[model samples]
Target chain A: MYVIVSGAGSLGSALAASLVAAGHEVFVIDPDAALLARAQEDLGSVGRAGYASSVAVLTEAGAARAQIFVAVTPSDEENLAACQLAKRVLQTPRTVALANQPDNVRLFETVGVDAVVSKIDVLIANLAGSLPAHPLLKLMPVAAGSREVVGIKIPALSVAVGRAVREISLPYGSMVILVVSADGKVQTGQPDTVLQAEDEVIAVAPADAAETLWEALTELR
Target chain B: MNVIIAGAGRAGAALAARLAEGGHRVTVIDPDRRTFDALPRPRIDSGEITVIEGDGASNDVLEKAGIQEAGLFIAVAEQDVRNGLLAQKAKLIYRVKRVICSVKDEYLSAIYRGAGIETVNPAQMEIEQVMAMLGGV
Candidate 1:
């Protein structure tokens, strides 16, 4: 889908990366050159950037043809106006306005926006569940699921805990087994080495082969 | 007198209604159609106010909102980035006098001021108000 995003803040940048990774044509609208440059670098080959003030940004974003228009700027008012402009003026089919103020959601419904995403609400909802033990590992790209990266700690009781890479069949579709540190260091493509207890392994597998890989790697059911 | 407000949220509507009470033409652009109905009771009935639910960043909306002839342009959005963009367009492109932007973050507020846009921050104001009550001001 062709998408146009207004702003290049944390949320905007993350959303752009997520969508681009999903193979969508994304156009970013931001006036800050510094932020734009950072976004360009972060998004790399998957996306394009334009100054928010330029007529070319809107024209090239193909506002009329865009499948989704997102106004995720921090300002509730700016998001509303941008979304309104995209819909009522640019004739974009669907528009989502980010309503920062929970109380102002009523304004969203009353104002006729297609949808309103409440960041506060999302954070609140997430907190209701047991905060995942590995909070930093939250929200991996779903497409990455094709490769199916799984994190596991080797235990001393396991028979293969001290075995070398060539000693075990390992998991099915486990082409790459990377050891990531609690401190975030990564050692990839383990060719030959003794696996130690407490060592973390990130194994990748094809979608249908994850269970097989898990069983082969770990003794626990 | 014509006024163009870039955001259709509460503050923008309040300002529009206040301006309209003085008999100025007011147009507010917001993505939410509900903003039109969500406006304070007085602002909605002002008859002189026109609420166009859509983006203020769009040149078409800017033009339709009469940005060219606008006496004042106000951008009071929740996001500093959007407010700054609309301010730049209003001042540099449309040549509107008295471009007022509402910035929530002090860091962004400083940046917006450095970029030569007049800014008001409700969050800062509330903070200051609280501080004043506590004798911190």
Candidate 2:
């Protein structure tokens, strides 16, 4: 997906990184130079820095081709304004704005923004704090509704360390280990390779199995 | 400024390639000798970047990589926790001026900052981007 994010704050930068990792073409529009620099450093090859509120910058950032245009600046007014510019000037199909204040969320919807995400709504959901809920939506409420995969360090004392991966009993679900970081390098899989004390394992399991998997992995200890 | 990367993993390799293209002295550190195979040795060398396979977390490795004079320190290894630890170590232990760490977890990224370290969480960033793309927000 080709996306233009109009904010380089925490939320904007986070979104930019996620999209880039998912192999999407991303352009970030931020008024803050430091945030843009940090976003560029983090996303590397897939990031384009721009001042998105301006029509020239949006045009140059290819907003016309954007599948999704996000206005996530801290200010609700700015976000709404950016969304308006995106819809009217750039002819962007879908524009979303982050309403830092809940009061402006309804206003955003009335103003024709495709979506308005309020800070309070986001915060309440994130308060649950379930690890591995959704790797992508770390602090968002979406994790509870979506499947999750998590990376964990296999403690030497865990029951999972000694047995073969297939033989190791786990919660009812499909399981796959994507990568194992041992001695500071990533290895995709080694069936015979024993899970050692410090090995970092990226495990894929159902989101609901998070607690169960954690217990099962640590039960033998 | 002369920069030395502590790991030659994907991020490290990419950074080296970019910094080298920009005409900066880059030296990569990794214990796995195989990383040298994946890295463009001649291109990096021609661009004035050096690759030394060794444990960058160790003082010996850093000393050999000229850590004493390095202005920038980037720890892009596999471990987020270790990256933060390395950043702290680089700042306090080695006194490196600029240190950047790569973390995958968003929660940990927020927590790691308390240790006086800067972090880049690619996964969290991806999440934010994907959310924007999918939800149009």
Candidate 3:
């Protein structure tokens, strides 16, 4: 797949390297020539030192033919604008962006950004994993953040513990894909499989259904 | 009408003052408190206009500036990209009826304009003014 990555920052560089290693053709753009040069060494000479939002820069980087256009610039505005230019003007099939602000997530997704990765949201979710308020940790967002894969831990004092997985009412558009036992055994989540304390259930769910699913599995009946 | 002007630069402050004089509730949001100096003191002191010292690109700042009830949002921040992004948020997220982004770069302005957001390109406007002065060339 042909990928156009905007920004040669740490995240962009890592992603470009991974995409290149995966055998995908990658072109990176950044206003910082030094950073772009450093990133180019890992990928190839396919780097442009310019704003990705520039039509000329994107044209030179072959954005029109790119299968994926991902912007991870420090500026959320730059990321969003570059993705918008790529998706709308260049007709790139998929445009992903790093939303620097947690609030920009909804705006970015609604503005037709194919996917949005909010570091703030991830950091909060990570930190909140230890907090009782956040029972499920979002592993990844799919379908432009409308849905996500979450890890829901079964608490020792939970109502669903020892109950069949099928008996727990997972919300609409949510289902347990896998369950990892306390002994670190990973297995497919079968409908009849009984839940156990300390079991880490990995589930795919609509983003809004997280609270309901978490409560259903963790709360006392 | 309720108006929120992002950036208290000369343009933003002047616009805020003029809008407030027009009887519109105006709020000027900027990251630098120093920039708020551009705003007329009497207007801010009298509560004819409000000033918020915060990043106008941020959602919190916009919310604090009363974006929920704003009818118009103007982004005249230093960076073209920041202005475009804020304008989009005000229009799409906050559901503001009108949004205008001041983008100096004509190319960037055109791109934002293509996306259905209104934009005023100072550079392009200057060129147009010069061309008009040159008498229909």
Tens digits of per-residue lDDT for model 1, B1-137: 89988777788777877888888888888988877775666656756888887777767778888888898989987777678667866776567877889877554455456646799988878988899899954
lDDT of 2 by residue, B1-137 (tens): 88988778888888988887787888888888777666777776575888887756556777889888988989888776446545655766667878888877444454445545678887878889999889875
Best by TM-score: 3
Point out where model 2 deviates above 4 Å: A45-50, A129-221, B1-137
Question: On a 0 to 100 scale, what is the lDDT of residue B41 in model 3?
Answer: 93
Computed on alpha carbons, the lDDT of every model, listed in order, comes to: 0.70, 0.71, 0.87
lDDT by residue for model 1 (A1-221), tens: 89888778898888999999999988787767677678878886223355432334555667779999887777775676566556655678898878886644654555466998988777755563333322112213246566566666554344556677677686554654586544666777566766665566666666666666555555421
Chain A structural similarity (TM-score) per candidate?
0.54, 0.57, 0.61
Between 1 and 3, whose lDDT is larger? 3
Q: What TM-score does chain B get in every candidate? A: 0.87, 0.86, 0.90
lDDT per residue, candidate 2, A26-58, as tens digits? 888787778788988888833445545556777
lDDT score for residue A81 of model 2: 55
Which is superior by TM-score, 2 or 3?
Answer: 3
Ranking by lDDT: 3, 2, 1
Q: iRMS for model 3? A: 1.7
